[model samples]
Target: MADQYAHSGEDKRPTETPAIRWEEPPEGPVLVLLDQTRLPAEEMELVCTDASALVEAIRSLAVRGAPLLGIAGAYGVALAAVRGFDVDEAAAALAGARPTAVNLAVGVRRALGAYRAALAEGGDGRRAAEAALAAARALHREDAEASARMAGHGLALLDELLPAGGHRVLTHCNTGALVSGGEGTAFAVALAAHRAGRLRRLWVDETRPLLQGARLTAYEAARSGMAYTLLTDNAAGSLFAAGEVDAVLIGADRIAADGSVANKVGSYPLAVLARYHHVPFIVVAPVTTVDPDTPDGASIEVEQRAGHEVTEITAPQASVAGAGGGIAVAPLGTQAYNPAFDVTPPELVTAIVTEEGVVSPVTSEALAELCARARRTTAR
Candidate 1:
């Protein structure tokens, strides 16, 4: 069977590292980015100077995918305060731009509260901005480190489950260096395994509405020189049915207190199939993404996307699926409910991998204990 991500390996090796950084200007406050929309084709960074630019970046999907969005949101708040905007209003605006990802709100609130405290003691705008920027930069570093930790835990789980010489994994969307400060969540582990000589192949799902897996994951895989193959979302069922899939690892947008996961829209279906196939379904995310505040999966808000996303399709290279089907698939005026994400109950999940460690059973106690251990590791 041809591996899914092989389609992206046309490039012999990856040339650049995927990361978003803070720039310390001589006169102005720290300058950060609003990543450009065109990637793999063109890697551009937006030099942000205001809150509105950051808001537009988040809204336009210029800087998206959950983990990256949260980090960008944190930097946005820091940027706003540095540019002399009201910290409270800046944080609010950043938090409001996206409702689904708990990480975004958490990152904003984390910076906001810290900035507010400094100002309460008569800190100047400069001092406040620096404080917020420091927090934001800290998060950037933390996210990178978290990615590595997730890779370790995910790999350990793989080693435990598969006693084979090489590991084959299937994943949805794009969880790579571009999605985090480090290599990434799910893809990070795959890349780590590849480097460790344990990875046999990677399957990148052509995530619909946007082909993040095809366009982004494939791009990342090509650079890394990893063997990969791309397949349509529907084709995943065929892979699972054929027993070609070893395990499914994906990044999470949000994790409820009870361990129910909210990830890309198609992830829930994959979980259902994983159970049928006796495959492990793993969710990799940072501790920051876990929301104890949202009691369960039902409480986590889902973002409804535009009908156009489902109706129209765009990609760097059009699939050889023939012509005329080239245009939007849905007829005009057709109502489409495109929720950006869907929740998968803990029962469907085999394990949730955090930077701290892999937690099975996914009970509240297990989840809490895992998180506390992660914090302790970081503290030490």
Candidate 2:
């Protein structure tokens, strides 16, 4: 059994795996990620002692997910300052690692803002580091709460849309305990439904290039004792064709002002499939995933990945160097185009569930009203 931790032992989370880490870090500004590459097997932390190392972790996906990346980036700045590296250089390096990730930029800018303010006040590096860590922790706490609220709102929407007793939801990539500060974004909602006796079975897409769903998400489902089955990315269409899915719930990397969501590669295709199958396609993410400044999907830059992810499939549990334990699924020397994420148009998106509530379609007026209502609720 995966080691269990205690929260309030709250009814909100009624699973063997409690909410992941509700306490603050013992050491300030250190990046500790549950090494995701190893799942359904070993749970390990990739602890970083410095900024550059943290950057490598993000680049290598030792740590990932937009919200998690934001938290890690903030800590990276703090780590840089703590280790005597120039804060500006740290911000530059961290922000430059992933160009398309809005969270990375948000985290870097937040830390940079704190560092500048502290410098202006003639504070030492220690105090500045403390401030940076404080920002990251605040983000972390807020994200956890957002996860809960989003799950509630999303589950409600699911109940209304499907109105069926048992729901089989299709999701791509890993968006669960390993992806966020807590339960997760999309999977959190599905897990919520499971707790409420609504979830039938979860369809885990073996996300290609990384297999996050096959490896990480499935591990979480198994631990939580949720009925889950994993299949290759290509098999999702078959499931939808057979009417196995009632809805599609996935987390977003970024949502433009026009509500064009960017998620893991192959998400756009699922959106198309859902539309054809008359399934309710929904996106569940925190308010942090939205970028009001970015106008549309056309403006969101899609990141191209390395050829290796396409050329070979490594055993998720293999530790040996050059382990062919995973087969070479793709042809050798064939140039491959791998975009880290694909943009889903608003027209295809059925609704967007945030911590506040569900937003209908994608429109400036509707989203603004939804956001305003959310702010009012938060204020209370």
Per-residue C-alpha lDDT of model 2 across residues 1-380, encoded as one tens digit per residue:
02221223222222233222223365543455555555545555566666787778778776788877777777778778766789899899998888777888888888778877887799887888777767766777777788888899999999999886698999999787666776788999999999999999999998988888887788778767799899889999999999899999999998888889999998999999999999999998877678878889999988888877777677645643322344666666677788999999999999999887788866766776776776687679
Per-model root-mean-square deviation over C-alphas: 5.9, 4.8
lDDT of the candidates, in the order given = 0.79, 0.78
TM-score of each: 0.90, 0.88
lDDT of 1: 0.79
TM-score of 2: 0.88
| Most accurate candidate by lDDT | 1
Candidate 1 residue 106 Cα shift, in angstroms, is 1.3
Q: Candidate 2: deviation at residue 200, Å?
A: 0.7
Model 2 residue runs over 4 Å out of place are 1-29, 317-327, 369-380
Q: Evaluated with TM-score, which candidate comes out highest?
A: 1
lDDT for model 2: 0.78
Q: Cα lDDT for residue 169, model 1? A: 91
